[model samples]
Target: MEDTQVRDTIRSNIANKKHTSDKVMPGFFLLMASISVLTTLGIVIILVTDASKFFSAVPLKEVFSTQLAPLRETPSFGMLPLISGTLMTTLIAMLVAVPIGLAAAIFLSQFASDKLRRLLKPLMEIL
Candidate 1:
């Protein structure tokens, strides 16, 4: 029958596709993954080399100084400002994001209908 022939054709197509996937997909993925891994390893190696050179020239104690003075002949370095700035930025981001995220979660849970929540949940999750 025509239906049996169609079924045979479908099976044949799937069988051929399976062969390609079995042989090709893993090798393609491995090549792509190797490229990414090698790139990251190279970057890390370069950073470590540069950092070692810098630390050897500048003593670790100076880098951790509490006071900064760029006016003098030998300028003082204080890393406290950098650390404080990082803390401040984190605090500000949390202050803004936490309330907004909490409000969105509350709104989704309490106010939104199931259908609306279903639509919005995925969109919010993407964000």
Candidate 2:
């Protein structure tokens, strides 16, 4: 009887409890979602409009040229140098990181206990 009365009282208290968050959070989330959608649409519209303007005046070949400077006097727009530099950096980083990451993964997967693996997996990902 005491247990039944306690449970009923707790249930009534929970049923009556109301938070500001319960009222405001749904509307806040909806507003944020709409803003994100509007922002994406606006960016796509702007990019298409400006891309059409740029491509009308410039040839696609010059934009993708492998040579950094195609002409002596003309201003260069070639992206090969930037692309190559980025690729080189990525290669160097991978060369340094891949072996270490693979060794750690092998240790975690092959040897670590289930509890340790579960705990470390998220920590390693964060690092």
Candidate 3:
């Protein structure tokens, strides 16, 4: 009888408990998300405004010109080399990383025991 009464009391308490954390958590997350978005926008606005000022002061032709200037002269600002380098590095990184990442994921999911998988998954993510 005591066990039955205690179980009933516990069930009632569980059912009656207000999920206040659920209500508060979304507000906290939304606040954090808004802060991040606002910060990004602020940075982008500063960059664009500064860039506009720079572009206005400097000649467009000078920026895009192909001839590499002599020492003691302003270096050519042609974007091709920088852009190509970025693309090449991106391609190389993807080629190397994608296969390794996929293989690790496959190994973790298929070969590892549940406890080992749980342990390794978080470690891999942190790395």
Candidate 4:
């Protein structure tokens, strides 16, 4: 009878703990999600503030113009060349990465076992 009482007490304690955890888990997850959202909002606010300051100092026309003359009093802020360079880089990166990624997907789908595919898929996503 004493052993049964002890077991019941232990079971009640575990049940209470599990119930408490179940109640708190959603609140904990909400707090974490709120923190992430606030952090993202803060970063976006900072970026917009800084961009506004920059645009205020530099005219919008100059940013889009394509007259880049170095060794001058005020360097030209032509964004065309930079934008083109960025686009080219993105194109090259996609050209290189897409084929390999597709090949990996095909191999995973067609050749790899279910367990190996599951493991490698997550590993590739992490990488």
lDDT per residue, candidate 2, 85-114, as tens digits?
A: 999999999999999999999999999999
In model 3, where do residues sit more than 4 Å from their true spots? 1-42, 59-75
RMSD vs true structure, all candidates = 3.7, 5.1, 6.5, 3.5
TM-scores, all models, native as reference: 0.78, 0.66, 0.58, 0.72
Candidate 4 overall lDDT versus native: 0.93
Model 3: lDDT of residue 45: 100
- Global lDDT of each candidate: 0.93, 0.88, 0.84, 0.93
The runs of at least 3 residues in candidate 4 whose Cα sits more than 4 Å from the true structure, single-residue gaps closed, are 67-72, 101-127
Ranking by lDDT: 1, 4, 2, 3
lDDT of 1 by residue, 1-98 (tens): 99999999999999999998999989999999999999999999999999999788878898888877868899877788889989999999999999
Count backbone clashes in candidate 2.
Answer: 0
lDDT for 73 (candidate 1): 91
Which is the winner by lDDT between candidate 3 and candidate 4? 4
User: What is the number of backbone collisions in each predicted candidate, taken in the order shown?
Assistant: 0, 0, 0, 0
Error of 2 at 67 (Å): 3.6
Q: Is candidate 3 or candidate 4 better by TM-score?
A: 4
